[model samples]
Target: MQPTFQNIQEAAQRIAPLIHRTPVLSSESVNHISGAQLFFKCENFQKAGAFKMRGAANAVLSLSDEEAARGVATHSSGNHGQALAKAAQSRGIKAYIVMPETAPSVKKKAVAGYGAEIIMCKPTLQAREDTLAEVVKRTGAEFIHPYNDERVICGQGTAAMELIEDTTALDIVMAPVGGGGLLSGTAITTHAMLPQAQVIAGEPQGADDAYRSLQAGKILPSESPNTIADGLLTSLGTKTFPIIQELVSEIITVSDEEIMAALRLIWERMKIIIEPSCAVPLAAVLQQKEKFAGKKIGIILTGGNVDLEALLSKF
Candidate 1:
């Protein structure tokens, strides 16, 4: 089922008590550098340390008593797994998260901390899916896809809805496209609430399937995605791809170096700790300053679930 504006609204009300109404912030230095007014919806501060919580809460809450009793399951690299775990804990239900072995230790620890059983698999997407399938078949858990499900998409839309409500006169709403869940939600909400605003997505150059898919007019699988933005390594899902294709105006690709620079800028100047995935949108803005010059842009800072020990050691 396609998620609509009303679904997003209902999701907002449904998950209201379950998640934080994260603050919208701006950095003057960032604005000056980008030559645009950048308003960041800081989902990094959200419960579970990511905006995925909004969708996870909605999906879990929307379940019937019988369905909830069966529990929920999904395959995730990090944020979504932690989100589903947190949401399931809130509802006092079981959650089985199938995670890639390559996912950051911090994210895996967070998922486990939320009381979900983590099943580790090979780093390949195929392995993650196969593991999840086996777990679901054995456990009778309802598979709540990380990005492709209608409930999850509607739940994701709430973040952008709140962003539009708390801010004024946004010319564009931007998010980093991983499986396209957040971007799809952002597009649906922006088109509904602020029809004049364009919805754009930022993707890592190394993981440019979303960009390639848009150009090819189809959903393309992501293979050998090599980037620091671990959260964005997945390809666009079936449900998310259609919504993004219809509503998103563009998909911008930025290199790893640019993403790192943007990440550092946000940390040094804005004093916010963001993971590399969260910096992709800002990297896009900085990479193409002329396109966004003098515009009011709203960027969703997706998550802050960085492996600090591993990251800091490089510096």
Candidate 2:
């Protein structure tokens, strides 16, 4: 079954102790820069250094004792791997993480540090799936999909839930769209709780399949996405696509240059380190200044897992 508002509520309660209720922060400088009153739902401060922890914890905890005893497995670029590993460690179960060989070393090391066994595969969707299938088949581990599961969607929605609860009368809520998990959850929460608020999504121009999919009125798979925001490289999931098409108000695409500018601005002005994927929404806001001007907006700053050397080399 698809996740519901009640599921999100339950997820909040279920993962409460397991995750931090990350802060909602605002920067006066950023507000002036974007021409909006921005409330950043700082999930970058979350456990596992990303909002993926909420979904990973909920998915692991929702399993039956017998199912959990078999352990869990998934293919991730980074954050979800770390999150699943952390959750499994906390539950005293093994986790098998299948990761792309191209994924940042920082993230790979972090996943390893969490005690999950890492299986590296060629950096393609097919290779990751094939590798994960072998691991799960061999170990009898339950597959917990990164973003396509109902429990995960519900858990991801809690970030937006907390954002709305902490702020009042938001005109719009925004998040980056990749596999559409966070955006789907954000749209669901905003639609149910702050019905008046519009939920917008930002996509990198280099990987604008979500934007194209919405325009095409169907799920268009992401092919060879090349963006500095490595976290937003996946295609939209079946479950996440329906929610996004129905509840999300709009999607805006921005260039890598715009994303880098927004990233630098946030780093310089807010004095916080955020991954490039986390900068997409803020980039959209800055790019479309007229639409967001003077509006109260909430943006989810998704993660902080950046490889300094790799990122610097990109420039």
TM-score per candidate: 0.99, 0.99
Q: Superposing all C-alpha atoms, what RMSD in Å does each candidate have to the true structure?
A: 0.8, 0.7
What local distance difference test score does each model get? 0.94, 0.95
Displacement of the residue 105 alpha carbon in candidate 1, Å: 0.9
Winning candidate number (lDDT): 2
Write candidate 1's Cα lDDT for 1-315 as tens digits.
788999999999999999999999998989999999999999999999999999899999999999999999999989999999999999999999999887889999999999999999998988988999999999999999999899999999999999999999799999999998899999999999999999999999999999999999998899899998888998999999999899999999999999999999999999989999999999999999999999999999999999998788656
How displaced is residue 230 in candidate 2, in Å?
A: 0.4
Q: How does model 2 score by TM-score?
A: 0.99
Candidate 1: clashing pairs of residues: none
> Residue 98 error for model 1, in Å?
0.8
